[model samples]
Target: MATRKVKRLYRSDVRQARRLLRGHTRKTPVFHTDILGPRGPVPVTLKLEYLQHGGTFKVRGCLNALLQTRGDKTGVVLASAGNAGIAAALASALRGMSCTVVVPESASHTKVAAMWSHGAEVLWHGTTYAEAHKYARQLAAERGAMPLHAYDLPEIVTGAGVVGLEIEEQVRGRPPVLVAVGGGGLVAGVAVALGLRGRVIGVEPEGAPTLHAALAAGHPVDVDVSSVASDALGANRIGDIAMEVAQRYGVRSLLVSDDAIVMAREYLWREFRIVVEPAGATAVAAIQSGAYVPAPGERPVIVLCGANTDLATL
Candidate 1:
């Protein structure tokens, strides 16, 4: 058997992204609270990352990738389910570069409108995101533009890792962190930053089990996406970087039911008066559903990763 070459993410890379991201992102606030566990009450911290610009953390990666294109005077192209497209468009607009976004026809109307509002030339491709991604790459090649990926890029993953660095400084004691997993970008980056200090748990909707599927298969495998959190966490397969990072750093995985995701989203509104989309609340769902039972000594941090929900749906 031969070992595969796995590209690793480094803390130094995270620091560089942090340097590049200065003045471009917000240090989203965190709230401390306790949740009931089977043993007793377990302390938990909620990282309100949904308040990030563009109402999602996608802006960090998009901005970092855009800023890195220093001398290359080229347009940008993107294929996103929702938030990433909006982030790419906004970043390009801020940099005064042209951007084109290709999205699935099934994407949220509000999300599509947001990309257009951010000055992206939005195009509707096929219904599935895979279809849109292929088309977006073709268009990028045709225009000689840079293609900004939602995940699976060193720049994008490193930018997302900055979130973990921020968490470490804001909260003491190297707490176990729970982050929602979509394409494995955010969790992978966070794991690289956190290292072995504490456990990094990736939570996902049972319907969209990309990380779980990859871990089980020992490689990235396409899975069916049909979760309430699908719009944000609907990467059909986890990226190679995420799978490798998980294997190297011992990142844990948890699956929560779709019903639990809905309930958790509602609970955030009723109990904490916090507004977040389904994907944002998915990490909390692990706790609320008892899918992840915290040890008495473990204080887990839940990252609310997105807030691009249509109020009508809420």
Candidate 2:
């Protein structure tokens, strides 16, 4: 019922999004690596999305939306926990447009700096992301600027689906993919990319179970947010498009604890010398913490999605 008015995204839409992206976004690489499993070294693929421009896959969606709305000179206004705002700012700059981002006071100072570096007018609005998002909507209306939703808009999800499309070309088989979920845009885009035959698992932090709660309620619903990964995956509710995709494809949801997220982030650094934010490590956390055990002869792909964090904290 909560998803009734949501627009459905097709695989075709993802393809169109890809076309819109053109030379704007990066085709981030996937590294085939093995993690030490319970039995032995378990093979796993890591989609190194942190290497993407703006240090996250959120740039893909932002570029897609901005490019599609190329003629609009009013610019863009959006709210993000962090990464989405940076993405929107950078993408808007790429399009020769201005960006104004309203971020919660709790947003990462590092990510806020990144947005400023991209020429975004960063404003601190509230204590939480929801409150900032509300103010951003009102601000956008007043300025007649394009309002961007971090994970709700079809362009955002479809642009992210291009990652899946790349995966299909790069990976050998239809291995299961574990993608971190905030408001469900990335996972829904992945589902469209992998199609019916491919398996896509949505991973969330237990402290911020937006998609998990939405799936359980059979509609989008708000949930309280608290997690180390909350800065990136802190959406209070899953978007309607994401909810529709979940129902249409029966996309399963899983939750990982904040401890698992932190450990996984550290593990990637220790083992691979790669750095990611807590939200980026969540998909791997599901495997590391035993939330989703890989099947025999199964090598899952974990999408490491963000790196917009303070190095001093890491």
Candidate 3:
């Protein structure tokens, strides 16, 4: 007899993760606004995840992974673009665990510095995240460290899904969520949590359109990754978990140009005094550029995912 496998992230799992992460992570607040939609001024909500610990939502997943580690677990190794590495390193530091983070040469100095500040041994590997990831996997196997993927693993995704649970609790009626997509873990987790209650719209930079390519091909596939937001939003391919959830839940994908992303970042600062990185502002870019138009009388919600950036750049 075939046994039915449990889902990687059930509602109960997400709830438990939220409880476990309560003190470790912040319950980021949502801000409401009226944006000019296709029809007229439409109500909108912004999830200020940039204010989250480690300056990004990645901390939730990292802390969850750290908390779930067994006594026998010795060390952690992972490849990251930036935020995930910083979050993982921070979590490892809090747990007194040894951690190593490998990142592409293209990773931001500000983010790498943050990771180091948290006491993680950091290595600069290849030119792109994909290249760094390959090396990290090999190193982890050789060192016997627990391999951590930024967005692919079930536990990581389940941890990230806690964001969705918080959103539903903060805003009743399950408003459509606009999420910035990199490797797609955040959106996938959100989709799993929200299910039929809300719609998940994934926004990617046009320059690094991994999920866009995957959606067009009807499966995850390699794509050339480059963008102003690439350091934060770059992934060579969409994860299998993300693709499965997207397909099952009908998650829609959208793209915004680098120009739009820059404008959105500036707009956020100018209008709301929010300093967000290019990747963090990608979801807002979709709305500001009309790449994503809200339905009449529909109040959409955008997840402002990260704020890890060189303030000098801002």
Candidate 4:
């Protein structure tokens, strides 16, 4: 199997992202969170991407990759904790291509069910997304399938950049900070989109601080995975491309706790009727737990990136 070519994100990539996601994704509402704010009611905006197709922002990248490989009937293979698998499956089904997804044992049943519903073959392996990814790569080589990485590929970053572009358009005025990070794709693309407009804060679960660890060591390095948000934000190491974009663009990384994620999840659901998974709520968790504090009257935008959790578990 050929090694996939990974490209660095740029201004042009952001432009393409907007064009690709124009009609597919919801211009998800950005609303204030009154429940978790400063003493003077610090206004916050939530980019509700949970309403996005395939139940997360993963669809944007998945569809972008499919568009690039339109003539490849050999199909594609991927491994995801949940959201990416569902997105890939849905995109492949819509494009009339075959897809096989390897998912970790820890993947939520709801996500696995959604993938199967989209007519993709689902394989369960190992105990985490990274391990499943290894197996998926092997399988793709055996099957002559193109491998689509969840967060490390250029097309994926370009597609995810749409989120940042949408946020800029939706917010009207400049926001002080945009908070989000996971495997570095979302935040890296977003950082490029912001592009000197505002600061981008990359929030990682304390248990799995891949980007944080990378920053500290001055290079990408493996980190332990033990966070509640591990499934979604659980890349052991940041991608070289993502790290390059992040460093070049001046993105900052912060750590947030699992308890904070739980609180943010419940807070959003209780206040705004928005249900998000642990990984999706990490940005909001940063603000809610005071891990990321905004300056006086500084408006911050928190991306609610996914909603793939089982409601029953909530």
Compare the candidates by TM-score and give the number of the best one: 2
lDDT of 2 at 53: 96
Tens-place lDDT per residue, model 2, 168-283, is: 88888889999999988899999987778878999999999988898788888889998999899989998888888877877899999898888888889999989999989999
lDDT for each candidate structure: 0.87, 0.89, 0.86, 0.80
Regions of model 1 farther than 4 Å from truth:
1-6, 35-42
Predict model 4's lDDT versus the native. 0.80
Least lDDT summed over 10 consecutive residues: which range in candidate 4? Answer: 1-10
- How would the candidate models be sorted by lDDT, starting from the highest? 2, 1, 3, 4
Output the better candidate (1/3) by lDDT: 1
User: What is the model-wide C-alpha lDDT for candidate 3?
Assistant: 0.86
Count of clashing residue pairs in every prediction: 0, 0, 0, 0
Per-residue alpha-carbon lDDT of model 1 for 1-314, expressed as tens digits? 00256567788888899999999999899999976544556689999899999998888988888888966766999888998998889889989999898888888888888888988898999987888899999999988899878888888899999999999998988888999999998999999988877579999999999888888877788999999888888789887888888888888889999999998898888878888999999998898888998776777899999888888776
lDDT tens per residue, model 4, 65-164: 7877855456889998888889999888877889999988888788899999999999999987779999999999998888999888888888888888
What's the true lDDT of residue 184 in model 1?
90
- Could you estimate the TM-score for every candidate? 0.95, 0.97, 0.95, 0.93
Between candidates 2 and 4, the TM-score winner = 2
Per-residue CA lDDT of candidate 3, range 212-297, in tens? Answer: 88888988888898799988888988888888788778899999999999988988888788999999999988888888887777
Ranking under TM-score, best-scoring first? 2, 1, 3, 4
What TM-score does candidate 4 get on C-alpha atoms?
A: 0.93
Highest lDDT against the true fold, candidate: 2
Count clashing pairs, candidate 1: 0
Error of 4 at 24 (Å): 3.0
